[model samples]
Target: MNFLIEENRNLAPYCSMKAGGNAKYLVQPKSVSELCEAVAYFRSRDEKYIVVGNCSNLLFPDSGYDGAVIITCGIRGISYENGVITAHCGDSLSSLARVACENSRAGLEFCYGIPGTVGGGVYMNAGAYGGELSQYFIRGSFIDKNGEIVVIENNDMDFGYRHSRLNYEELILLSAEFSSVEGDRDAVRARMEELMAKRKASQPLEYPSCGSAFKRPAGHYAGALIEQCGLKGTSVGGAQVSVKHAGFVINTGNATATDVTELLSLVSDTVFNETGVRLEPEIRIIK
Candidate 1:
């Protein structure tokens, strides 16, 4: 009931790639009650809706979405006490990492440079530098499709390579609790700095991308396979496979969602033809 709704909202500004078309209606609810109310309101009217976290790993089509887009970026709340970090779904991963580092925690350093909310990271089981969210997560709270809050333990999360069971379900992550061990504060900071430096050195961080475009192929690297297929630097409209890192497809200014989709399809097909192994896209495309 306390949601702000806007008409003809531009979706690009909300997303990392800045390439999406407009959303017919956009809603931003401030709290759990407001979010649930908005969901119920939409459902009562038989309207379609999509929930967006930080909008980092999504590509919205050029045709635009006809339904409501509920953005959760303003729902952030974080608390740390007794070696436990409890963060709301909208809390940034970078912020979470900083909080952990300041508290002498070591497990979350790998997420220091990740550009997404805690909820999105958990949904994707996001990992980097050989460390993943699953390792530190103790439990998560989510709102089911019926607007019921449910707590799921780490074992029930079913986290796998860049995916969790939540990806296939209609649950909306509300918050997460991570358990960390005490370590040297300075050492934790140093580790985070080193990981950030490595990310900057190897990735095309200058452009807008959804990080790795594809999951790693079996027994081989996705980027290496793309490079071997001579698909590096390939472009479709304003979207291009990054030359610096073939695993990334970047928005080189004025790119459309269609462009990104086309380039991804081309890369996947080419890689499969050359290696006889299919490449699964890591970036989620929303219609």
Candidate 2:
């Protein structure tokens, strides 16, 4: 009951790519209880619904979603005790890394600049600079498809390269716990800064785009292959393969959902034809 709900909510602004149509109904719950209440309410009806975080890696269709879109970014919290860190799903990965640094904990330096929320990060097994959330992950709580709360242990996480069990399951992530080790406070901060610098230099952060357009295929790098095929800077309307980083498809100020999707298809097809390796999109296309 304690949440914001609206009709015909525009989703473009919420999207990292700044393109998308809208949601028939949008819900932003401020707490886990409210999230569950929203979920239950929607589940009780024969309505379509989805739980989202940050909209960082999602692409809503141009036609708009005809359902309730529950955004979890409003629910956030973090804490550290006895070498263990706990964070709510809505807490940003950057905040999680900062909490670890302030507590003199290491191993989370790679998360310093990740734009995804805790839930999204864990869902995708997000990683960078040879470090992944799964390496430090302990366990998490979630709401099942039936709206029942459950705790899944570390052993049950089923984490893989850029994936987790949550990818296939209709479960809603709530809060998660991760483990860390003692480290020099200054050293941890320095590491975080180093990674952030690398990110800024390599990524096309100046424009709106899903962080990485394609997953690395087998033993080859997606960006390198794309660039090798001379697909960088190629555009389909306002969506273009970033010249700075071929792995990203950026919105050139006025891109639409159709433009981005068409560009993604073009790039993937081109890459496969030239390199013999099919590129799979990393962003979730929600139609």
Candidate 3:
């Protein structure tokens, strides 16, 4: 087939954290059709496979993955029409937000600075600063385990606080449509820039990190709790709790997955000991 495939590919370069080992096999699909074909190929062989885009919120183990890693970042495409954006799964969330602003479409300005892809954002119901992906979701399509295309509406997505029904199923996202409201272009851009500035000031944007390490606890914020426990700037090898934002664990330099995993456990245990609340990681770790 006319598809790109690599052997023993270093996965660190593919992830934002840049701390993972290699993937035995990596597939880069440039379109929805190619993604489907790649899935079918791996499935027919009864081999393990995963659909990934951006890898911004993932923490891969140092041992590396033994199966096929199908990367859809190459499948990028997007268009805006009639107050709606139809975008491929691989399209960057930032790009989508920019397009919306350019079209004078509001509501997606919150996603303007999120470092993830459309598929990843939809899968996790990504949100920031009082805005969530589910709010604008209309419908989408995915390839089910049976190799059939399944169309899902917003209701069927089952979006909830950084989660979606897609998380529970063995399906690959293809594309999605999001609805937005008409607003002043200047206002949208200004809001986006404001949010970005806030993020830079409060977050450890200079370091490589998996964004927020812990999900927000019901009654307390993760960063606040970490700071309360005096865990800011804590480090396990090259992995360190961000001094700027205690909620994030950043790779100072040459950090291994083991260091990150150990650091996460330490933070979780310490936080739970200091407070009754238990902090759970928001980033997905692959062993």
Candidate 4:
């Protein structure tokens, strides 16, 4: 399998937050087979690498990464058979929901505006409005550290509040299947549009962010806690808690990874001090 290896590539553009440095080596796989080949190649060469898809919720340090960054965004495909939908790791979660709606299938409407790919989504068990991927997720294929493909079922995913076995495992997702029941396409689309409207109204979509900045504390909303502490519009360098949504720490044009991390820490501390609820950041802070 032929592939290109880019060196000294800027990593900021790859992340949704648009705040990062550079990578020493980068491999973008164009297909699942290519992804497997790339992983095997790197593993055999004893080269350190980190797999990423979409980079929506990831924060790369400004100092940059010295090893291979294996990006799966180019490996995308989706299909529907009977009541099940199969998607490549690089497939967009939003696109998956839309395809489900198109096939007259309900559920997954909450994924409409999510910016991550299936690999990232499943790794974190992404959800919204009480809808979670684990609900419909059946099983998936992953590439182990040895470069061998392995299958894991829903029962083994260990899904819980934005957590999954992918958190502790060395495997990387390749593809997954989901099941959805039949529904009226019109109603499904309408519901999706309504949710999107709400998102636009409530989120700081005009600024680049990692969606929500913090996980919701048990019986408490992260945003409300930040808002209650009068932390809205707070800024650390170019990173600011969104005035539009206290839950988001947005990059105000020139934000750096340090700025974002500082702002996140400040918000979490302030919220905890005032509300007694320690907020755990949802963003992945990568070195």
Local distance difference test scores for all models: 0.90, 0.93, 0.92, 0.92
Q: Higher TM-score: candidate 1 or 2? A: 2
Query: How does residue 56 of candidate 3 score in lDDT?
Result: 94
- Candidate 4 local lDDT, 77-100, one digit each (tens): 999999899999999999999999
Clashes of 2: 0
Query: Could you tell me the TM-score of candidate 3?
Result: 0.99
Candidate 3's residue-wise lDDT over 1-287, tens digit each? 86877889999988989898889889999988889888988899988878899999998789898899988899989999999999999999999899999999999999988999999999889999999999999999989878999998998888999899987987778999999999999999999999999998998999999999999999889999999999999999999999999999999998998999999999999999989789999999987
lDDT of 2: 0.93
Q: How many backbone clashes does candidate 1 have?
A: 0
Candidate 2, superposed: residue stretches over 4 Å from native: none
Which prediction has more favorable lDDT, 2 or 3?
Answer: 2
Write one digit per residue (lDDT tens) for candidate 2, span 4-71: 77999899999999999989999999999999989988888877999999999999999999999999
Against the true structure, candidate 1 reaches a TM-score of 0.97
- Pairs that collide in candidate 1 are none
Per-prediction CA RMSD (Å): 1.1, 0.8, 0.8, 0.9
Evaluated at residue 106, the lDDT of candidate 1 is: 76
